[model samples]
Each structure stands twice: as structure tokens, then as C-alpha cells.
Target: MTELVSTTPGLYPLPDWAKQDLSDLKGHQKHDLISGDEGPEIVDVYDRAREEVVSEQVDAGLDRIVEGQLRWDDMLAHPLTVHENVETGGIVRYYDNNNFYRDPQVKGELTFSGDVAAELDATSELLDDEALQAVLPGPYTLAELATNEYYDDDAAFLDAVGEFLAGEVDAFPEHETLFLLEPSLVTDAPDEDLDERVPDAIDRIVDATDADVVVQSYWGALEEKVYAHLMDANVDALGFDFVAGDRDQTLYNINEYGTKDDIALGLVNGQNTLVESPETVHERVEWTLDRIANKSFDRAYVTTNTELFYLPENRATEKLTALAEIANIPEVKA
Candidate 1:
């Protein structure tokens, strides 16, 4: 029997309290204040924001819950950017979207910091009995996003990043699911050499954890070769951006390179302002499952294609409600 799970990709939008200017602090100063002892008010804002996100997910009957990544000011790059040896520099476009993250300038050897783990712990404490899932940037994506000055080559850099991320995975508390967000794998499209190296790095990061790891890519469907490579990766599941990507190509890839692991169908559009109806979402999910009936999958996760932060809080909540409704449909589950 398949499990009906509804979840977000992390990084929910900031609440009104979080967006307010606190005493005119600027740039890194603001970040420092929130992360430092001088910012209890800012910390309270994030705490309340996370509580709100968790409450909504539970109310919507989602099977899994996330920390909402309320403190990820730099999106997926936050963990790396805040490292002691890394410096935040000029802004860079985050994937194909209007969002931006400061480029991470690596000044020395990369090491795992416990910031992400601490955030997860705080959020996990807030959850009643619900299973908490942690989200982190994938190794290859982080390697591509940062400017490396200490590594000898791309291969070495990827290895270091992979090891660093594995340490982060080790630091996480007992979690039911862990999502390694890898949008760069699709948006940047690594060359043949890096393509071969990426899966190795992914394996290193995933092998360190026993939790079910889902390597989720968004913005678009992966190139044929990359798609095929990920199908054979050591991860437990592969998530496709069906909402923003080519649905036909995604289904073709799944058929061509069959998977034994679960498939997370990104049925909700996280980037768009329009909220899809329950009927439309249920039909699309069934349509994909019907085409892949011959393949063996342990389960299917119905989720948004990307981070819900792109949409307003109201639309994001509505989208989650629709996903929950669709997942519970008897025909869709059957």
C-alpha cells in the first residue's frame, strides 16, 4: 500500500513580524543580531513563525512536517554561507527565479557547522508527535554555488563539500525524512565529468544517514543523462518538479530508467501565485501514477515543486490544503 504524504520543500515565507525592520540594522548586522544574543526579539519572531507553519501543516493533515527554514535568509546557501571560513559576497541569481542569495566565498577548508542541526532541534521540540523532516542543500549544488579558493580542483571541492554535508546529516536528530535540495543539478546542468562525480558525492552524503533521504531537484526537469544517473543514486527517493518542469519528459525518464525507491511527485506549483483546485491536482497525480503503474515504487509523496516562499502565505497555505485533499482522495490513493 502507498502512503499519502503531503509536505513542502522548506523555506516558508517570513511572517509580517519577521519582515519588520528592527531598529534599522542593515545587511549582515541584521543577520548577526538575529543569530546573536542581542536579538531576542528577532529570535522570538522566527520562533512564532515556525510555530505558525507547523500548526498549519498539522491542521491540513500533512503526513510529514518541516522546520519551515525560517532562518534561511540565503535560501539553500545559508548553511554554507554562515560557515566560519566562508564569506558572503556579491549577490547571485537563485536558479531561474527572481530570488537571490549571496555568493559564498570559500576562504579555507570547509567544515560542518551545527547551525542547521540546532535549527532542526528547536523546531522538532515544537512538534507534538508528528515526524519532523530536515532539509539541507545537496553537496554538488553547494559546490557549484560557492566560489572556491582553497580547493585544488572541482573533484576535490565536491568531495570536501560532500563530507561537510555528511557531517551535517550526522548531526540531525532522529528524523523520519531528510530532503537534500539540489536545484543546481537541473538549473546548471553539470558537464560529463561533473555529472559522473556528482552521484559519487551524493552517495557519500546519503550513506552517512539512515533516514529516508529524498534528493529533490526543481526549476526544471533534469537532462536525460543526469536524470538517469540520479535514478541509480544511493538515495531513497527522487523528486521531480512536475509543476514547473516538463511533465512528459519526467514521466518518460521514470519509464526509461525505472526506480525501486519511492517517488515524490511535485504536484503543487510553489512558484506561481495561482492555487490549483483539488480536482485538478487529484487528476494530475492519478494521471502520472497510471502511466507508471508497471514500475515498482514503495510510496509517493505529493508536494510542492519548490519552496513555498515564492507565494504569499495565504496562497501557500491554500496550496498545502489542496495537496492534502488530493492525497486523501480514495481513487488517487488506490
Candidate 2:
């Protein structure tokens, strides 16, 4: 039987109270917060915020829960910027959106001290192993997003980023799923060497963990060659952006290249303010499933096409609740 699951693919928006608390901090204090050296008040804010966000997912009846990633200042660049060996450069726009993230200028070989893993471990204390889903920026996306001044070649730079992430995965507490977000595969197409370079880097990142790995892409569906090469990787599933990307191209790629046993469908529009109804979500899920009927999947996760941080907290919560309801629809579950 195909199991339908409901979950968020990336970061959840910080609650208004948490946002207010952050707004009260000075410039230097904000820097300390991002570096994991936050003062007691800010630490308390994250602790309480994480708990509430986790509870929100549970209360909404989501099958798999993400820890909300309330602590991440920016998705792909957060880990790099926080590292001591990397210097934070000027802001760069995140994809085609108004949101921006600091560029990480790598000054030396990257190393990880398990900062992200430790954050996941904290979230682990709040949820059981069966429901927890870990999230991170994919190595390819991270490498492409940063300004590498250390490594001599792109391949070596990719490997170092992969190793750093693998170390983070090695230290993580138990989790059922790991979402490695790779939006760059679509936003900025890699060179022709994608087949030769990408899979190996991806392998290094997932090799140490037994969790179900999903290389999630957003903003758009990947090009044919990019999708084909990614399909060759060891990941359990490949995610697509149905809302912001070309849905037909995404379906064509899946039907043409085939997919693994598990897949994630981005049915809800994460950036939109208009909340989708359960019926609407169900219809979209059915449309996608119908198009890819030739393939077989054991599990299908119904999720937002992008991070929920773009929407107001209330709308994001509504989106999550709608996704949960869609998963249970008789037509979708069957």
C-alpha cells in the first residue's frame, strides 16, 4: 500500500513572540545569536519557540515532524557563516525572492563541530524516533551558494563541504528522514560535469546515516540532465517544487527518468498568503499521482513547495493543517 504522509520540507516561520524578542536585540547581540553564543534570554526564546513549533505540527496531525528550524538565520548559508574558518561577506539575494542571506567566504578547509547536529539532538528530546525528520542544505547547493576562496578546484571544495555535512549527520540523534535541500540544481544549473561530480559528493554526505535521505529541490524543477544524474545517487527520493516550478516538466522528468520507492510532492504553495483548502490540496495531490501513475512508490510525502517562513505564522499553520488533512483523504490515501 502507498502510505501518504504530511510534513514541512524546510524551516517553519518564527512565531511573533520570538520575532519580537529578536527585534529587541542590538546588532552585535544578533551576531552572537547566529554564532550559537546567544545570551540566556535568546536561548530561552529558542527553547520555548522550538517546543511550541513542534507542538503545532503534532496538534495539526502531521505524520512526520520537522524541528521547525527556528534557529536558522538563513537556510543554505547559515552553517557556513557560523563556522570560525569562514568569513561573512555582503548579502546575496536568495534565489528570485526578496529574502537575502550573507555570503560565506571560505578561508580554509571546512570542518564541522556538529552545531546543526546538536540542534537536532535538542529537538529529538521532544519527539519520538518515528516522527522526527532532520533537515539541512545539500552539499551541492551549499558549495554553489558560498564563495570558496580555500580549495583549488570546485570538486575539492564540494568534497570538503560534503565531509563537513557528513560529520553533522554522524552526530545527529535518531531521525526517520533527512531532507537535503538542493534548490541550486534548478536555480543555477551546474556544468556538464554534474554526472561526474554530484553523485559522489552526495554519497559522502549520506554514507554515515541510515535515515531515509531525500534530495529536495525547489524554485523550479531540475533540467533533464540534472534530474537524470541526481536519480543515479543513493538517495531514497527526489523532491520537486510543484507550486513555484513548472509542474509539467517535473512530472515529465519523473515519468521519463523514473524515481525511487519514496517521493515528496510539494502540493502546498509555501510563499503564498492565500491558504489552500484541504480539498484543493487533495485535488493537486491526485493530479500529480495520476500523472506519475506508471511509477511505484511505497511512501509519498505531501509538503509545501518552499519554506514556510515567507508566509505569516497564522497562514503557515493553516497550510500545515491543510496538508495533514489532504494526506488522510480517502482518494489520496488509497
Best by lDDT: 2
Model 2, C-alpha of 314: deviation from truth (Å): 0.6
**lDDT of candidate 1 at residue 263, scale 0 to 100:** 81
TM of each candidate vs. truth: 0.93, 0.95
For each of the candidates, the C-alpha root-mean-square deviation to the true structure, in angstroms, is 2.2, 1.8
Q: Across residues 1-334, which tens digit of lDDT does each residue of candidate 2 receive?
A: 5688888876888899888887786643333455566788778888899999888888888988888877777666788888888988887888888877788899987877677887888888888544889888888899988999999888889889889999888898888888998888899888996546888788887897999998889998899998988988899888889888688899889989898888898879999999899889888877788789567678888899988888899999988899889765775542
Best TM-score among the predictions, by candidate number: 2
Clashing residue pairs for model 1: none
Candidate 1 per-residue lDDT, tens place, 1-334, comes to 5666777788888765557644343443334432323356666677788888888888987778888987777788887887888888888888776888788889997877888888888878888889888898898888889999889988899889999998888888888988888999888888887788888888887887888888899888889999887766788889888877687887788888876468888888897888998788878777778888476556888889998888888898898788878665774443
Query: In model 2, which regions exceed 4 Å deviation?
Result: 27-33, 128-130, 331-334
Cα displacement (Å) at residue 289, model 2: 1.1
The stretch of ten residues in a row with the least summed lDDT in candidate 1 is: 29-38
Q: What Cα-based lDDT does every candidate model obtain?
A: 0.81, 0.83
Off by over 4 Å in 1: 21-38, 331-334
